[model samples]
Target: MRYIFFFFFVLLTLSGCNKHEEPSSNLIVSSFKLPPKNESAASSDAKDEMAAPASPEIPQKIIKEASLRFETDNLEDTFNRIQSAVTLNKATIQNDSEGKDYNNIYRNLTIRVPSQNFDAFINAISKGVSYFERKDISSQNVTEQYIDLTSRLNTKRKLEERYLQILQKATKISEILEIEKQISTIREEIEAKQGQLKYLESRVSESTVTIEFYKTIAQKEGVKTSYGSKIWAAIQSGFYSLSEFLISIISVWPFIIVFCIFAYFIRKRFKRKKK
Candidate 1:
């Protein structure tokens, strides 16, 4: 009877161990609940369940931009207004250049503004242009990019915090060095993200004003080329050709000398044979 009782107890213990053992890839999103405050062991079990994952949860956010193109007649005034609007919007100018086309001088301007004032600033800029040659406007939806950056930023921040915590709690010198290295990488990533955000803000604030100045065609008086100038050009060309010929002769002198020597030796050999 005692043997039977011992065997049953062993079987029960084996079954309990199997129940407690979790799978290698357990993805538990929600927290496990405890029975009661008195069940401290159960609460500890729930806490252990939460702390099993090696990686921290990353939060996602989407970053996007809107592009605008406008043409204007009042180049000077429009440029001034654009600069002012950029200042007011707390943004910066990214690019400002003149377009290539002699007949029509076009100014291409890029401004970075805040996301909130995107539509308003665009509308304000549109009002300034005399004639809208071509207005091409579109939104670059960076949903994935934003989400990825947010996730990475969140992860890095968490890592930095954890490293800081480790720096305080760490006892070993090796562990402290490792934590510091991680902190450095995280800080770099944070700074890079900040720069990216700043750049985006500057671009969004000011609308691109490609001011093309169209000049009316006037009858151009043609000046005849002077006889002396034509003569000088011809002389210069002749001098260049003469120099090129001299350079070519100088370059092939070694080959020419070798050929001459060979011919002389053949002539001497033939004379000696005839004699």
Candidate 2:
């Protein structure tokens, strides 16, 4: 009876100790253990969701340009008309040139107008001219390119934000340096994308038109004949030709003198040999 009681007491004591120790081991593990793989994965997924932001919706992007060439009776008058048309259409003359070549006068103009007024401005120009030598209209669709740039910009911005966050949390110097480098690269890319987007937007909003017009001087009929003027012109031409010939001779005077001296010596030597 004594042995049985001792065995029962020992077994109970061992069981109680095991139970108490099990809880302690569990507490230790819970305090010091890292998070599970699934939990870490979930956190990363959540961060990604926060980093990637949505982009705004933009409509079609189109760049329009035109070229026009025409002839006019009076170039100066046509130029003034073109300037007035540009002003009336609320456009700007980006470039302009006017010059006379021989008896013909020509003017060239490059204008920029709002996309909305492009067609109206073109019509006004056409109305001012009598006939067109060349007329060309061109359109470039940049919608896809614009959208692609926007997407890339958004992605780079998100990446930069992520790197900033990581930089803040980084404890090691090496880790911070790497994160900063990545952030700088992402920032530069973002700025480049922004510049491209702005340029594209500007091109899409404004339209370009080029105009070239010219006039030729007309010859007058029934002019009185002038024999005296023709005779004077002939005399002047003859004098000019004589002057040019004299100048050519003067330019080679040194060479001519040397040749003459050489010829005299050679003739003297030949005469002495004959004697």
Candidate 3:
């Protein structure tokens, strides 16, 4: 009976010790444990409101661009008109090129205007324009891409923060080095995302316009040629042809001599056979 009571007491003591020890270790692990994945996802935008835009419907990101090519009577006048429109709309001229092709005089311009004034600037430039030789206008939607990048950047930042927290608690040099490497990688990724976001914002804010204006030269009426002038031109053409033929013959003089000699010998042989 005593032995049975002793065994029961010993088992109880060991169970109590285990319960106490397990809880302490579990608490330490839980303290260092990361938050639940669901929580992390839900709080994606909580840390940074810029991750997602406030309004769901408004403020869509759109990039606009246009290309215009047309014929103009006067290049200077067309350039001046575009300049006036650019000034009126607070637009900027990025590039200006002027050159002539065949019988056409052309001027090309690249302009950047605010998104709000995209259509207004186009209309302003179209005042005296009758037709467009080539006109291309396009718009791209980047709302989803912006949102995606913003969200990803925010998430990476949060992860970096977590790693930093763990770094603070880290005691080993190896652990510190590894965590810092991860932080560095995350920072690079963050910078890349930031660059992408800025590019998108720039495109969405300003619209690009390319204008090409050209003038065609009309053909002049041909003058009547006098009879004497026609005779002189014909004589010159014949002289030039004769000179070219002589030059060609001179170039192959050795071959021509050989062919003539062979022909003479064959003629002599034929005459002797006939006799």
Candidate 4:
């Protein structure tokens, strides 16, 4: 009975110890012990409003520009459409030539076409030719170029405006001269860029097409000759030869006469000395 009472007393002591050592279930535990909210509701609302969706950023004015080189075998057809292409593309023929050898006559032409219709224009041009001698199609993505031009132009324009304003406010002639000089230089640069843009626009507007063709040698139809006609031609040629000979002799008659007179005098002097 004493052993059972001691066992019960030991169990009660363990239970009381466990109750004292137990962790509080209501106590909050977290890895990140963050600070309490100090920001006002309006401030939090403003932050929420400022946050934006993860939308892909769009580029401004995506410019399309390119250049190409193409060669064709059917030069005739190529030439025919070449003018039209130039007009359509606002371009010009850079080079064109046609020549003949003993056997053949070949034609060569270099043309520039527009960039907007570069591919479509090339397709149209290819259809006109028999076959391509060589098709060298290339593309230079000039989005960067256009963007660069725009930036440069904008900056230069602002500079130009500033210069104009300075010109208006100038007090001294020297200052005016210096400003004018600077303005001139800026204008020259602007003109150069404008020219470049025009050229690029023209290139993009038109495609360059180089055309070459060789004419095939054809057989002679027939050989016809008459004996009477040949004789007549010979007679005419002989008469012309005789007239030329007579004219040549007559031309030098004065010199010939002088030589003969000198010769006669020398002979007479020799004969007199011998006598």
Can you tell me which runs of candidate 1 are displaced by over 4 Å?
Answer: 1-133, 201-209, 219-275
Q: In model 2, state the lDDT of residue 63.
A: 99
lDDT of each: 0.63, 0.83, 0.88, 0.66
Name the Cα RMSD for model 3. 9.2
Point out where model 3 deviates above 4 Å.
1-58, 221-275
Give the Cα-based TM-score of candidate 1 against the true structure: 0.42
Tens digits of per-residue lDDT, candidate 4, 142-222, equal 656865675565556656776799899999999999999988998998888888777766555455666565655554411
TM-score of each: 0.42, 0.64, 0.64, 0.46
lDDT of 1 by residue, 4-84 (tens): 999999999999877776542243523555444432453344445545766654333323344444555566776788777
- Top lDDT prediction, candidate number: 3
What TM-score number comes out for model 4? 0.46
| Model 4 misplaced stretches (Cα beyond 4 Å) | 1-96, 128-130, 218-275
Residue pairs with backbone overlap in model 4:
113-206, 113-207, 114-204, 114-205, 114-206, 114-207, 115-204, 115-205, 115-206
Ranking by lDDT: 3, 2, 4, 1
Candidate 2: the clashing residue pairs are: none
